[model samples]
Target: MHQVASQLPAEAVASQTRPLLVLENLGKRFGSLQALQDVSLDFRVGEVQCLLGENGAGKSTLCNLIFGVYRPDDGLMRFAGREWVPAGPAEALDSGIAMVHQHFSLVPRMTVVENLMLGQSRGLLQHRAFAAKIRSIAESFGFSLDPEAVVGELSVGERQRAEIVKCLMREPRLLVLDEPTAVLPPDEIGSLLDICRRVADSGRAVILVTHKLAEIAKVADRVAVLRGGRVVAKAEMATADMGALVRAMVGREVKSLDVALSESGAASAPPVSAGDAPRPRALVCDGITVKDRHDAVRLDNFTLEIRAGEIVGLAGVEGNGQSELGMVLAGLQRPAAGRFFIGETELTEAGPAAVTAAGGGIVPEDRHAVACVTAMSVAENMYLNKLDRFTRFGLLRRNALNQAARGLMQEFDVRAAGADVAFSGLSGGNQQKAVLARELTLDPLVALVAAQPTRGLDINAVEAVYRQIRAAARRGVGVLLISSELDELIAVADRIVVLYRGRLVGERPAEPGERAAIGALMSGHGL
Candidate 1:
């Protein structure tokens, strides 16, 4: 446990009304692991309370206890000026508490309206009015949704919108959101924060659990830092800075994204001299065009070139051809026309195996589906694309493979039960790290394509991924980083390009001041 400074700021002092929910000396354990201990906090009405910490820091564990998903071994909790104990989520919901999980709990086969009316006592026709009300609320928060739309057909952001609507339908007095921005785009994060602010202003309590430090400054009225399953620090948002929050969470000084830019002197791309020759090409996409299963044009004559020792970032909103482009680069999807090359070797119409054999690496957006086999052991997953190296006389060298897996796990700092453990048992961040370790460690790597590489990662894990990408670029590897985070693109990419409706809308040097322009381009506005 760390020493928490017990000084209240002006805002915290003035807003010290009766707390909506209070927890005192809360403690919980799972077998030998103490998930939470001595966690005490007060969540006040009409304010946003943020639980800030790295992954597995007891943030979600505390939320589960409040939502009745788990029973705290030792604690005292009071709600509405009375002792409160709930048996399950239904009891908690009926008591004016609702939790929106990181992974939504809506039934995919049902319509949005049907999903919202699942446990309501009201009739089905009454849900029509509820649907109208939800639409109005979503509009106010700049969310566009269709109540009649099937949940399975909704995009990631739209599904989150439906999840919020479901929570609001219950009129929850205390609303808890876990990692709300994990699947949202960079631009949509502001809108989500605004929604939280609006909910708090409506005289309701909001508890936001996230590891992104930037989010704390954006919406948190009060911030609680959890570390090693304990409340290590607590301070009013007005009094806490990023540096303070980082120290409390990780117990060390870590360079934030902005600070890294300042130290690198690469805030903006440098100008090329007239005499400078064109850089040697590492990856080239020549007039490529693609379509989806529905015959919707996904890539419209997309063309781009990346040079060795350079990083080119692809930025766009979801469903704006980024996914299709990444698939084409990884040789998973056959482009309708045009072709791509790896360092002068043409790889048009090639499959994923040939592309990997040609020294190309792919870190997909969805690691589970494309990168690793969840049912396989960690060692087997590491050699998924390169199993030939460990095979002899039609048999796999199990001992040699396990030895290599151990070495790679140690090098990647992968925290798992063991190399023999199934990949599915690992956390999301660890799974992504495994993919990176496998892809980046390839010999004679020519080009690397990473899509949303840091999605759902904690601060420490994000830093590690960034360092690995930077190291790859330093080794003269051409890198294509496709992400929704503009801040991430500007931090490391040499150039940033925007895709809109399957077309290249704009291209610019990665610069700090160009974010607004890039955002406009991403939304299919001005070039």
Candidate 2:
């Protein structure tokens, strides 16, 4: 029997051990774009190396190259003192390298155990043995997962856990995780960080690719900042503050939105509106209840009213019915009970088209799934929902569409070459801006939803989005903002509501330093 030590004491080892993985002069190019250029870094064993960058800043590209999704055009990867070039994912796995992609790659129909064992060596195909191994590994990592559960039936956090287990099952010497906590709730995120620490404690190296600076502060041992496809900064986590890190990533001075708000005189604004401020009720949900396929209530007894000229923020951990609630509000799905009213029109059963036609706009959480068609041109995507306005009878007026697209591009300050460019060619921040421009141009009475709105965006772009949302609210458009980032919610929302296990657990007027209270509520504690 293998008897591994349960814990390693502080005095047990030397600090000068060689790194487990090293990249020297890594360069990768795709057509005209140089995704990664002459990047170099070393990942030490039993350490968490945090990689931070803005969208399209070559963080993902570096990960893809390291994991063998794309080979580096000019680079040398050395693992355990041996030169290595992984030809593909399979080869990478065989060479003790494993990567969990930012986007899920599991087949929904497959069982958890099946997905876990999918790419295992042929010798481990025996069902009983494979299941046993998966369970054992899951237990070791403090992950609770049902081997027989289908991937489609699992929550987002569970699915992520399964991915981690799959990587662990290979006994990888170096593990690469991309945006692993993007879908997790705050409490669950702590658990994930614990898992990462435990994995490293087991004498393996971990590379965490994320944009969240707070997570880096909590868990990273060392950090590497990438900007414009190059490693701009590398330093010990203890020696870096959030301000310093932000400056390193963006190459500019950093200031919190709160500070900016105070400087702009928004801090003196009244917490709750009073007097004759139009008091227009834009959105109302009357005792709404939504059930999933299993007849379980995903949203229960949910009653809320969002007034025009206000932003209502929903704060919760993932899988607390935030997605379902957002979908229902956006009219993408019907509520099982009660009704949603836009002005006086009941929209409980209204389809997406009807809701959109009623001056309701949506920026869905899953961008690729609901927001834009990646393969289509920016102009075509811009006119997707408002095509009829630009079209004359049955034929599309291409010139009008292009004209509108160009106008929106200039208005939103979307940093793309032209409207004719494909949506996929733009960065994530730019794509989100495009979607926002399209949705807001309709002059909607109620802008239904936005999830993680500022995620993957640089400071300047995030500020632009904030300004747009604030302007919309000022124009008497009710806005619903859903995000796990408490700082964001507090920055923009007039009111904040916490969701816990499919129920509205708490509500508070937005105030400074109220995040801790809201976070407690989100974790199922009374505030």
Candidate 3:
């Protein structure tokens, strides 16, 4: 591993309290991209320090460097008055530092206790004692997880609890959490924040990486905003607010969802009439019931409709049948009992190809897995759904494909080195943009189903996506937008529908001050 002596200036090191962890002038490079440059920070014991940034602003890179996932190219690190350079994650853990990544690392086939004890120098049957100890610690943090339950059988929230339990079992001095609350419900988010607070209060330092500005107030003692591989701003939570953070991160002002929506006047539009001749039903589902591969009910009698020239937002917590509903609408999965319609034509069991032929577009939740091919070029992936249009006589036309891809890339502002670059080389926001450019550019589109459309995007990219979705509605294409963010639904949707446990429980016009009511319904309370 790369190692260097202390290059941090004495004044910078002396300006803070005795720090448990210190990083000075840290730098990392991935091929041509400098993921981190001259980054410096100090972490004190018994405090929560939040790392705030856009998707590609190098927050994860810093955490990975500290945790021994990547060796820094420059700078030095000191921990507890000693130079600290861990060769790997095992050494980092041995030095009392543990990490809970966004994606959990537990073995799915193992039980909770078994997974936790995998790396420990203990026999297989010795997990019972460990399980009892973990159960007590988990209860103290108010997380209810069965020690004997298989990891695969737990819910997302439960799995997070198990991950945290695994971390605490090691009794680490410094804990790092990356976007821990991204998939959690509002109630679970409160619990997770409470857990973080307790961990910090017990003399352990916590580093939280997140994009949600609102979460900073709940647990952050200090906040650092990163932009363009630099720490643009840092402040104590007592004096910092959302506006200041947004300005520092993006170098400009940004309006909140409510304020932006109010200025746009989208919520004041008149409701669509069912009998309108010009705007007919573009997508319709009648009493759809679906089950997953494990024979669990995902959608129970779910029904909805979106007419042309309208944007309907589906709001719900993650894993509450949103994925199943999107799959059903995209014709990727066959509903057990339901009749789907695309502009008055019933399509009960049509596959993705048939749906695409009928003017349907899809932006899947897991974009890399379901939407794009990583090994393919950007130009090839752009025309994935409509290959025949660019092909003739069983021969490929590279020039035509590249030309069309370049035009759409320019139109959508897809930042890439070139059309022939690998699709995996693009950033997360640019990948989403490429998907949007391909779908929205399709002619005669009847319905567009977008799942988690703005996930992992920066604020600017999010604004671009909202504009494109609205523009598609104005172009006489029905749009079904599924998102976990209630504020996003309130901002861009003409009408919002709440889904709970595979059922549509509430529907309301996307008006101001409706978030509270919608949030209640999402948690199984009455509207």
Candidate 4:
């Protein structure tokens, strides 16, 4: 990886005649929270500028300001040497600025071409012309997008390509991407970086917003460290090493994974042994096939056995049947065909309650969307799945629930203001920890699914999660981990299964440095 300082000539040394965009004394406040405080930065055409910060450090707020989601409370934005204040998304796009949010924006039922042309303002309807434009753009960007393919049918990588295509169709001079690689496998991350570079080399500017320092080191030309809503360090990517960037972003020197692993005795340690032989099959699926609301098969011939004392990883690019499999296993959806068993009890048509009663615990993929109710208090949300444990005869038992929530919160190390606080008030990492706490505390015979369990978490929190997973396995709990992050999967899983196009295509032992090969298999490049 290039050091940050060597990457830039010097701040005193100017490379270009003019910057493409400049934010002067940018500031935004939400109630008492100073989300962005006097943040100033510049992006030049044909260069990739990476923004790094922890969650809630005001990175999203800054992007929201630039995208016109909320007008800056203070500061001036100049683009292409013109002062600009975009009214909204349309105005922002009109001003040669486009942003792809962390969350997907494409309509699930719409085709790629339809989505690309959703908000276009052509005076006359030109479906054919727009489709042709999409095809041309996709080809130029080395993207194989089926313009007629439904958005819901595309893999996460393909959906991301569609988003990029949507922005490219606008021909924006500056493209902003927020956490673009968060849902991508390690090997696919390189491809995304290549696409970003290609986009920038095409004479446009790219602003990458991410918290992963390794990714910044790989792709950023210029690195800007954001801390508490302020740019603490700005330097060339080639000159700034990960150490320097870590110091700038977190205001402290951070240890690398190797160092951390050694210090924690994670490396050079004997493999933790399972307590005993687990029940023959805690959860079993035989020839299972699942379909979506539209009756499209999202999972085909998926057969798996989860035994106690094992962590089974479902590795794939997002949208490659992982989400649907998780839903089906969790009993949120019933498979169209197949037999599902929890300890020999048939559950093919069972609902979530029945699944839970059958000793299944689910940590859903989308924490906000499906796992927890944002409006509910943390205590309430924590006990949502195990309400019967805290209540009797359909009457509420507030004391028991609160006690359970408090104990679990302490055990899980979930950082929250208070137990009564709304779940939405906590950070993303804390929310995930809360979800884990609830599901794992139930001590189910089988853990249905957990996706991106350590995403957006700090180093310490990640360590905690890893320890939790190990402990669960030691207790003879069957864990089904579904994630795009290959490193995490390899670290926690005993075996890895690759899914491609809604089918189980490959299997391998989880090993370090084998990510590229596994990713290739997941993309259907290997037999």
Candidate that would win on TM-score: 2
Write candidate 2's Cα lDDT for 216-310 as tens digits: 88889899988888898888987877777788888888678766655654432233546655566778889888887779888897888887677
Cα lDDT tens digits for candidate 4, 1-527 = 12232354444124333588899999987666676888999998667999887655677677777888889989999988888688887788888889987656899899988888777677975888888888887776655678888987665567777887787777787899877776665656776787787667656678998767777877788988787778888889778777777777767666654355446543321344587434556678799898876788889999998776677888887777887787787777778888788767788898988888787778776676578898998999988877777778889788777777888888988755567778876656678889888877775545446777776665556767777776676676777888887777777677899888899988888788777788888878967
True-vs-predicted CA distance for residue 437, candidate 4, Å: 4.4
- Runs of candidate 2 with Cα error greater than 4 angstroms are 1-16, 109-111, 124-150, 153-155, 261-274, 387-430, 456-461
Model 4: ten consecutive residues of lowest lDDT: 1-10
Candidate ranking under lDDT, highest first, comes to: 1, 3, 2, 4
Model with the higher TM-score, candidate 2 or 4: 2
Q: Tell me the alpha-carbon RMSD of every candidate.
A: 5.9, 4.1, 6.0, 5.3
Better of 1 and 3 by lDDT: 1
156, model 1: CA deviation in Å? 3.5
lDDT agreement of model 2 with the native: 0.78
Question: In angstroms, what RMSD does candidate 3 have relative to the true structure?
Answer: 6.0
**Per-residue lDDT tens digits of candidate 3, residues 21-112?**
99999888777778789999999866789998776678877887889988999999998789888899999999999998765678878899
* lDDT score, candidate 4, position 442: 73
Candidate 3 yields a Cα-based lDDT of 0.80
TM-score of 3: 0.83
Question: Mind sharing the TM-score for model 2?
Answer: 0.86
Between candidates 3 and 4, the one scoring higher on lDDT is 3
